[model samples]
Target: MDKPTISKNPTKKVASADHKNLSSIAQYLKDAQGSHKRSIPPLDQWQPKHCGTIDLKVLANGEWWHEGQLIKRQAMIDLFATVLWKEDDTFYLKTPVEQIEIEVEDEPLFVNQVDQIDIEGKTYLQLKSTTQDLIIVDAEHPIFMRPFKDELRPYVHVRFGINAVIQRAAFLHLVEMGELSENAQGETVLSLKSGDLDLHLGT
Candidate 1:
């Protein structure tokens, strides 16, 4: 098998031509957020199945039986895990909320976090960084300590791709409810009666 080419110094080019399109993409994200509601079903309730493991040959060729070129199995699994599905067969790589989860050590911790938020005060937490360490948590380890140490045991971990989608959707939903704004510079500027806080990228 040929080792996949890894580029170390890829060129950095500004996408000046697609600024308007990028703005539209941003708007789409905001719209998805605005349209989202808390009443949506949770991940476990949705019953998303593992759908069985698929090999790289089948994925790249869209056929069940093929002896075509093969990529590393790990790389293929990573690619498949990041993909999003629109219909039963249509697949893309964007994030969606139905697949996301917010995990806490206990119900009390979850409640405390929520209670810390002031009434009518907006709070933001970045799912990406919070779940980054758990991306590869060994299920055989204790859930609470898995984030800090590499242990072997079955543990529960949140799906970050889904979380990112949900957070973005929620933020945009607030804006549509007249709670936030996007400035001309394409920055998501939010407003609250109590005052506004510029949300840090990962927070």
Candidate 2:
């Protein structure tokens, strides 16, 4: 079945009065996000029955929305980000108790920053996500670019099949780090090396 069509802007601009109850939602977000830290939930090991879909949707820019209202709390976004998983092209919010599907406008997570590290002369790139998760770009977690509208956008696999969109600034960093090299077939290519793994960005 086809997924529901999301509006151009996933967050609809409701009347200002709609925000009168932000306190309650903020508290709910804080409770969910701040409730647990130190250790991540074992979502990979979770085997729960699939629950019905929810109105939750992750926007292309990494902001979240519920029932057309923006989820403006960073703590809440961080909380939901922890439980996110992707099966094929579908995104899910899973805990030990249950799993429910959610819509994603673009890539689920947004990678806003990138930094390079050197370990015994081996360089590795680390990605910092808006959700405060750090990921290493390596063979297991590689970078890719796809056409978005008229331009190409880069993304990297963070974890559990969740792809993080490399934003403008980080995209520039990745490009600056790229080196012009040759492929196995001696074809000219542009690639980035991280931890002894050379990922071809483009030819």
Candidate 3:
């Protein structure tokens, strides 16, 4: 199934904050974002000081929570996502002034939608996250299975050491679009291709 592309607007203001603690962080991000001309921030150029940790967490299911309260506004989440930065194994919400550590249960993002697009004569799989990040299934953005709980779950590289968990529905979609075949080791594997990039869905 084809999903709509990510929005190009970068000037959307964050939604009104319901939690006082989150409001402070949200305000800092908003102010730091002064005029967001770029769709994604230039996180590489930003080297802000560490501002300690916050009560923010991204749950395994891709829901964002702050101070034990679920963050329900998509605008707020999108705003926060623009500043998402990964250093080593820790995830942080970064700004021009400072960076604050946040906990991520699994991957920091989730692929909620998948689209199969025929570009010219080649078939390509496009994955979209809840925060409007689009990742093409290719060598640079390969999908691999990771152990979660007792089962293996699919994940894909997003950008700069950040990965997105493939939601079950999206994983099933990829399975339906994949080709079943035997690998070199005689093990059955479902293979998917995007242009010249080939990947085994789940072996």
Best by TM-score: 3
> In candidate 1, what are the lDDT values of residues 33-114, reduced to their tens digit?
4643312222233444323211112221112121233323432223233333333332322324222121111110000010
Ranked candidates (lDDT, high to low): 3, 2, 1
Instruction: Write the number of the candidate with greater lDDT, choosing between 1 and 3.
Output: 3
lDDT of 3 by residue, 27-59 (tens): 777776676542677899988877666667788
What lDDT tens digits, residue by residue, belong to model 2 across residues 26-129? 45445654655523567898897766566677777677777667887787677677778888788877766556677898877898899998878788999998
- Which of candidates 2 and 3 reaches a greater lDDT? 3
The TM-score of candidate 3 is: 0.82
Measured with C-alpha atoms, the lDDT of residue 149 in candidate 2 is 78
> All predictions: root-mean-square deviation over Cα?
19.2, 6.6, 9.2
* Local distance difference test, each candidate: 0.27, 0.74, 0.79
Indicate which candidate wins on lDDT.
Answer: 3
- How do the predictions measure up, each by TM-score? 0.20, 0.76, 0.82
